[model samples]
Target: MSTKDVMIWRSNRAGTHYVADTVVMEEPLEIRIRFQDSDGKWVERPLSITMRTPGDDQALAVGFMFTEGMLLKNQLDKVTIGLENTVTVHFKPDVRPELEKLQRNFYATSSCGVCGKSSLDSLGYTYETLHLAENLSPLSPELIGSLPQKLTEYQSIFDETGGIHAAGLFDWEGNLILSAEDVGRHNAVDKIAGKALMQQSLPFNQHILMLSGRACFELLHKALALNIPVVVAVGAPSSLAIETAERFGQTLIGFARDGRFNVYSGIHRVDALVLPKK
Candidate 1:
C-alpha cells in the first residue's frame, strides 16, 4: 500500500483559515465476477472491475456468495482469489439445486446489498435456533452504555475517513472482543465473521454483535447463519430484520445511542429492570 499526499484546509473561530498538507486513504479495489452458463455447464466469467483498499477480497467474495445463497459452507469445494481483480469459487459437481434461481440478471455491484433481495419474505430463511448457556449472564445497562464509545475507540479507519461502516463483537461482560471496518457495512460484518471463523470461535450465541448503521435484512440473515443470539445497532432496524429476529428467537436492539435504546425482540437477553416501549 503506497501513500499519497493531498492538500488540507483548517479554519479558526475568527474565520481565519490555512492550507496544509495531508495524506489521503486509498480506495478499495473491487473484484467484480460474472458467471457463464454454457449449455449445461456453469463457468466463471470475468466481467467488470472497481478500485478498493485491496485487503480481505477473499472474505468479500465469500460473503457475497453466502448472501446471494449461491454457495453454502458444505457446497463449496474451494474459493481461490487472486492478487488482481479475479476470484474463482469452485462448487461441488452435480449440485445444481437452484440453477433456475441463478438468473442471468445477476450482476455484481460495488455497493453492499442494502436492497439485497427481491422480496422481504425471501430474506427469511429457516435457521438453527441455539439455546444460550445457562451460565451466561445478561448484558447490563452499564455495559451497553459504554459500547458505542468502545466501538469508536477501536475504529481506526472510521476515525481516518469518517466514510466507513463498522461491526464489532463483545462478550456478555461488555469487553471489546473483536472489530472490523469496511466501506460496506455488510463487508465489515463478513470480515468479523471471517476472522472469528479463522479463529474457530464461531457460533457466537453468548456474545453481542453491534453494527455502526441500521439493522437490515442482510445483517439479520448473516447473524442467523452464525447463530448469534444478540444483535445491536446504532440506528433503527428494518421491519424484515425484526421479523427474522423474532422468528429465530434472536435478540434485536436498535436506536442505541445517548444512553437509551430500543429492544425489538428477545428481550430476555438484556438485563435491564425496565424494557423499552414497543
Candidate 2:
C-alpha cells in the first residue's frame, strides 16, 4: 500500500490556503519474466517497467502480458509477488517467451499505452478474436445507463485523486464483477484483466466493460484479447475504436450516463428502440 495524502496549496475564489489533499500513489513497477534458459536454469529477464498506482502490481503485469500477446495459458504456471516495486511472472519449465516479438518499451507515459510501437502496419493484429455478435444478448437501455454510476461507486482511488482512470467489469444485469483504477486507463484495465485471468475467467463475452473516459483503440484491443463483447464508456469513442469494434462485431457504447448512451457499433447487442414522439 502507498500513501494517499499529499500536501498542496489550493487557490480558490475565497483565498489561497494550504491543505492536505489525497492523491493516488504513482510509482514505477518493474515487471520481470522468469523462464528457463537453454541449460534448464531459470533466468530472470526484465520485461518492462511501468508507472502505476502501486497496488495490484501482479495483475498489471499479467494483464499487460496477456493483452500484449506475450503470454499463453500453459506458459503461465504460476505468479508470485516480489518486493514492493517488483512483480515476477514465472512460466512452466519447458515454456519460453519469444522475447523478440515483445518489443514495446511501454514506459514513457502513464496514460498512453502505445508509446513504443514499432510501426503502424503492426496495427494489423495477429491474434484471432472470438466473433461476439453470434453469442451476444441484448442489454437494456436502463442497464447500460446504470453502468457509469456503478463504475463510479467502486472508484475509491479516483474519489481521492480525481485524476485517475477506472475500468469496471459488469454482468448483463449491471452487477459489478470487479473494478480497478490507475493513472493510466490501460493499467486499470490490465489490473482487472489480470485478476480475471488469474481466476481463469477468460472469454468475458457476457460482461460489459465500462470505461471511465473516452474509448480508444488500445482499450478495444485489450477487450478483444479477453473476448469481451460490450464496451460502455462514460465519454466519447474515437473513430478508430468504433471501426475496431465494428470489425470484431462487438458492441461499443459511449457517452453513457444518466439513462442515455450512443451505440456506435454492433447495435444489435443493445435494445435501442426508438420511442414515439408525443
Candidate 3:
C-alpha cells in the first residue's frame, strides 16, 4: 500500500489534539525507453520523472509514451519494471522511437502537465484520432450527477487518504467502466488510458472520461488520444484545455458537481433539453 499512517493535530476551543491520519504516499517514478539509437547503438533513455502515487507505475509509463506520441499501442512490445524505481518500454522489432524529442531537462510534477514540452509548436498538433466522429448518445443530467458519486464510491484509496486524484470512464448511462487514482491528476488519467489501451479499448468516442480535479492540457490530450468525446471534470478547465477541446470537437465539461456543469466546447455532444434555459 502506498499510504502511510501519520499523526495529525487539530485545534479547538480547548487545546490541540492529535489523531492518526492516513496520507497517500508520493514518490518519483522514472520512465525510461530502451531501444537502439539511430546509430544502431542500444541505449536506455530516461524520458520523464513524474511525482506520483506509488502504484500503477507501469501503466503511467506506457500511457505516457502513447499519449506523448512517442510510441503507439501497436508498437509497444512490452514494458519491463526495472530496478531503482524505474519502468522501461521495450518496443517490438524494427520499431524505433524519436529519442531526440524526449531528451528534456524538466521534472514533471504531479500537479501539472507533461514536463519539458513548453513550446507552442510542440503542443500545436492533435493526434489523428481526434478527427474521428464522437457519435455518442445524449447524456442525461441525472447521469452526469451520478458520475461523481460513482467516482467517489470507487475511490477507496482517496477515501482513506483524501489526497489523490482520480479519472474514470463511464458509459452514456453513467455506468463506471474503469477508474484509476493517483497523486497526479494527469497520472490518474494516464493509468485509466493505459488500462483501456492494453485491453484494446481505444477510441472510446462513445464513452465519457471524468476527472476528479481541474481539467488541464495534458488531461485533455489524454482524452483525445483515446478518442474520448465527452470529458466531465469536477473543477475548472484551463484556457488551453478549452481551446484544444473546442478545436478537436470534444465536449469539455467543468465544474461538474451538484447536478450542474459548464460545457465550454462541443456542446453539441450534450443535449440542450437537459440544460437550463438561458
Candidate 4:
C-alpha cells in the first residue's frame, strides 16, 4: 500500500508552529477506459481520473460514468483494475452513447470535476427526472441530531488515517446502519450505493445519507439513482445540488451541526412541527 506521514503548521495565538502528523494524500490516478465499438472494433478512451482514496476504485469509476451520462447500468460489461494505478472499464459492444464532444480536463480535485454542471442551465441540461417515493415521512429532530455521534462510532478508517471523508446510512431512528470513508466524498457514497446495488437493496430511499463534506451534484445524482428521498450533510449544498433535489422532490438538509440544520428543498419531508401559541 502507498502511504505517507505528513506534518502541518498551524499559526495560533498560542504558537506559530504546530507539528500535526497526518497521512499523506495519494495523488489522483488516471482512469483509462476501453470498449468495443459498433463496428467490431476496439476503442480505447481516456476518461477523467480523480484524486481518490484508492479503496473502491471500481465503484468510483462506475459512479463517475453513471453521473457523467457515459454509462447505463445494463450496458456495462465489467470493470478491471490493473497494476500501478490504472483502471479499465469495458462496455458491451453494441452500447453506444450520444457523446459527441467528450469535454474534460486532466485533473479533478476533491472540490470540483470536469463534466458536472457549473451553472443552473448546465445542471438543467444534465438533470434526469429522478424516481422517488412521494409519501415518505419526516425524520424526527432527535433522530436527526443523534446522527453525528453515531457516525463517529463507525469511523474506524477515519480513526486510522484521519484523511478520509465518510458517508453514513441511517434508519428513521438514527441508528448507524452502514458507513464508508474514502479520500473522496463521492467515492464513499458510491461505495455505499454500489454495495446496496450488489445486495439488491438499492434505490436507497428509506434511509438518510449523511456526508462529511458539502453536498454536490454528483452526490445528489447518486442519491437520485438510488431513489433516496432524504439526504443530510454536515456541510452546505451547492446551488446545483439544491436544484437537483428540488427537481426530484428529495429533501436536502445541510449545515447539520449541533442539532440545527437548514433545509434547502423538499422541506415537507422534514415535517416541521410548529408549537401552539401559548
Which candidate gets the maximum lDDT versus the true structure?
2
Which of 1 and 2 is ahead in lDDT?
Answer: 2
- Estimate TM-scores for all models: 0.75, 0.91, 0.90, 0.80
Tens digit of per-residue lDDT, candidate 2, span 137-256: 678898888889888998887776788999999987889998998988899899998998888887687888999999988898889877788999999998978988887778899999
- Candidate 4: C-alpha RMSD to true structure equals 3.7
Model 4 C-alpha lDDT per residue in residues 1-278, reported as the tens digit of each score: 42456678878889878575657356676676777667878887777778877666776776666656566667677788876678777877777654452345456776554334565455433235555666666777767767777887877667767767889888766776667777778777776765554344555567788888799887887776666778999899989899888877788999888988888987677767766899
Global CA lDDT computed for model 4? 0.72
Judge candidate 2 against the unseen true structure and give its global Cα lDDT, from 0 to 1.
Answer: 0.83
Q: Clashes in model 1: which pairs?
A: 27-52, 27-53, 28-51, 28-52, 28-53, 29-51, 29-52, 29-53
Off by over 4 Å in 3: 38-42, 115-121, 124-129, 274-278
Ranked by lDDT, the better of candidates 2 and 3 is: 2
Count clashing residue pairs in model 1: 8
Best by TM-score: 2
Q: Give the worst 10-residue stretch by lDDT in candidate 4.
A: 119-128
**Ranking according to TM-score, highest score first:** 2, 3, 4, 1
Q: Is candidate 1 or candidate 4 better by lDDT?
A: 4
Alpha carbon lDDT of each predicted model: 0.67, 0.83, 0.81, 0.72
After best superposition, candidate 4 residue 93: deviation in angstroms?
Answer: 4.0
Model 2: CA > 4 A from native? 103-108, 116-128, 131-133, 274-278
Compare candidates 2 and 4 on TM-score and give the better one.
2
